[model samples]
Target: MSWNPAQYLRFADARLRPALDLLARIGGDTQPRRIVDLGCGTGNVTRLLLERWPAAAIVGVDSDAAMLACAGSTPSAIGWQLADIASWRAGFSPDLLFSNAALHWLPDHDRLLPELVGQLSPDGILAVQMPANFAEPAHRILRQLAGESPWRDALGAVRMGSILPPADYEQLLRPLCHRLDLWETTYWQVLSGADPIIEWMKGTTLVPFLQRLDDSAAGHFLAAYRERLAAVHPAGPDGTTLFPFKRLFFVARR
Candidate 1:
C-alpha cells in the first residue's frame, strides 16, 4: 500500500527501458572510484548501474525507507542511504551521479542540481531520465478527471509538480557539465486490456497521488481515473491497447 513498485510490474519492460538507456550512455573505461544513484527506487536501475560500473563504489540514496530497504536487499554492493536529497549535503567527490525516472519529483533542483553537480569530479558523468508525460493528456486529463470525481470533496488543492522542459534544463545544466546530451522521447507502447494507461501511471505519478490519500479515498481516486481512461482510451480491435507514453532523458560529463 505504501508506494509498492511490485504492483506495477506488468508493464515493467516499457517502464524500465529509459533507465537502461540512460545508463548505456556512459563511455568506456570511464569508471570512477565512487558513484551515486540519486532517487534510486526499488533497486531496478541501481542493479543495472552496478553491472555497468562493477568496481565503482556505488551509493544509493532515496527519501523512502521502504524503497531504500528494497534497494538494500537487491544483489549489489550499493550502499543504501535513506536521505532527502533536497537538504542532504555530503563532501564526497563522485565519479558519476546517475538517476532515472526520479528528478521530476524534485523541481527545486534548480538549486539542488548545481549543488549535486558540485559534488562530482571534473571528469564525472551525470545521467538522468524523467517522465515528461506530465503536461500531456496522461497527467492533465487525470487532474481534470479528479475534479469531477467523488473524492474531489476530500482531495484538496492537489497539483502535480511542474517539470521543466529540455531547453530549460540545458540552460541550467549545459554550463555545469560539458558535452551535455538532452532529449525527450515518446514511446508508443502497445499494451493489452483496458485502463492500461492508468496502469502505467501507477508505477510513476500515482505515487504522489496515493501517498496523500486514505485507503478509501485512494480507491475512489483509482476508480474514477479508470473510468475516465476507459471512456477516453478505446480498446483496439486487435485485442490489445495502445498507450503512447513519453519520457525525457539527459546525459552529461562534468
Candidate 2:
C-alpha cells in the first residue's frame, strides 16, 4: 500500500512517544556502532536514533519511495534505502535493530522474529513497538465495513489484522535473547478536530481499504466509517475526542 507522509505525520508527537519509549528501554553498558531502523517511516524515529547514537552508522530501511523521499538526508551520517523489511539484510550485523509501528504490516512473526534476532551482533539489541489496538472500535469498524456489500467485492480477501498478543511475542523472542523486556502501554490520546479517529486511521489502517476503492467508493466507505466512529467517540464538552490507543513494546538484548 502507498503511504501519505503528511497524513502519517499528522499526529507526529503522539507517534514519536512510543518510539522514544522503546529507545529509552534499550539501555546497556556499550553504545551501538551500527544501527538499522527497520520500516522507518519518513525517518522521524530514525532521526531520534541518530540523536541517541550520533557516532553510529544508521541506515533507515523502508519499502515506500514516497516515505524515503520525505525522509531525505540528515545532518548526521545516515543512509536511506528502499527495501522490504521482511527480506532485508544488513551487510554487517547491526548493534541495534529498531522498528516502530512497522512489523504489523508483515506476517509470520514465529519465523520472522528469529530471523531478525539472528541478524543482530553478539550483544546487539532489537527494539520494536507495534499497535495492539486491533480489537478497538477504530479497527473493528474497518473490518465491519469491509465485509459489507460493494466493499466486500472490491476488497476481496484483504487481511486487515496482523498484530499478535504480548504473550505471543514474548514466546517468540524469549529463547533467542539473553535478556528481554516486554510491556504494553495504553495511551488515552485526546485528539482535537473533526473525526480525528478516522483521520488517524487514514494514515495507517485505512490506507489498504482506500487504496482498493475508487474515489467515489472510498468516499462512501469513509462516510460510513465516520458515522460509526462519531457515534462511539463523540466529542467531549471541550470538543476533543479521547482515543485510547494501546501498543505493545519489546526490547531484546542478545
Candidate 3:
C-alpha cells in the first residue's frame, strides 16, 4: 500500500508516544553497537535510536521510497535502506532489532517472530510494538462498511491479516528467547478537528481499502465510515474525541 508521510505524521505526537514508551523499556545498561529499525517509517523512531546511542550504527529499513525519501532528507549519520520488512535480512546480526507499528502488516507471525529473534546476536534485544485495536470501532466500522453492498465487490477479499493474541506470541518466542516481556496498553488518544477519528485512520488503517477504490467511491466510503465513527466515538464537550487505542508490546532477549 502507498503511504503519505504528511498524513501519517499529522498526529506525530500521538504516534511518537508509543515509540518512546517502547524505547524506554530498552535498559540503559544495554548499549547496542548495531541497531536495525525494521519498518522504520520516515526515520522518526530511528533518530531516537541515534540520540540514545550516538556511537551505535543505525539503519532505518522501509519498503516505501516516498517514506524513505522523507527520512533521508535530514542530515544524519544513520543509514536508510529501501526494502520489504517481511523478507528483508540484515547483513550482520544486529544487537537490537526494533520495530514500531510495522510488523502487523505482514502475515504469519508464528514464523516471522522467531526468525527475527534468530537474527539477533547473543543476548541481543528484539523490542516491538503494534496496534492491538482491531476490535475497536475505528476498524470495526471500516470492515462493516466494506462488507456492505456497494463496497463489497472491491473490499470483499481485502485481507489485512490478523494480530495473534498475546499468549500466542509468548508461546512462539519463549523457546528462542532467554528473557521475554510482554504487555498491553490502552491509550485514550484525545484527538481534535472534525472527523478526527477518520483522519487518524487515514494515516494507517484506511490506506489499503482506499487504494482499491476510485476517487468518487473512496470519498463515499470515507463519508459512510465517518458517519459510523462519529456515533461510536462522539466528541466531548471541548470537541476533542477520546479514541481509546490498544497496543501490544514485547521485549525479547536472544
Question: What lDDT does candidate 3 reach at residue 134?
Answer: 92
Candidate 2, residue 180: how far the Cα is off, in Å: 0.6
**lDDT: worst 10-residue window of model 1:** 153-162
TM-scores for the candidates:
0.90, 0.97, 0.98
Cα lDDT tens digits, model 2, 3-57, are 9999999999998999988988887466999999999989989998888778899
Candidate RMSDs in Å, in order, are 2.2, 1.1, 0.8
Off by over 4 Å in 2: 73-75
Could you tell me which residue pairs clash in candidate 2? none
In model 1, pairs of residues that clash are none
What is the lDDT of every predicted structure here?
0.76, 0.89, 0.92
**Candidate 3: minimum summed lDDT over ten consecutive residues — where?**
156-165
Q: Which runs in model 3 stand beyond 4 Å of their true positions?
A: none
Write the residue-wise lDDT of candidate 1 on 1-254 in tens digits.
Answer: 25575754667788788887776667776767888888887877777778877888888888888777766775667788888777765568888888877777775768877888887888787788887777776687778765665656544456565578788889989899878888888888888765777667777677667777799888877887786676666778897777777788888777
C-alpha-based local distance difference test score of model 1: 0.76
Clashing residue pairs, backbone N/CA/C < 3 A, model 3: none
lDDT per residue for candidate 3 within 1-254, as digits (tens), equals 88999999999999999999999998989999999999989999999999999999999999999999999999999999999988989989999999999999999899888889889999999999999999887878788899998999999778654589999999999999989989999999999998898888889888889899999999999988878888989999999999999999999999
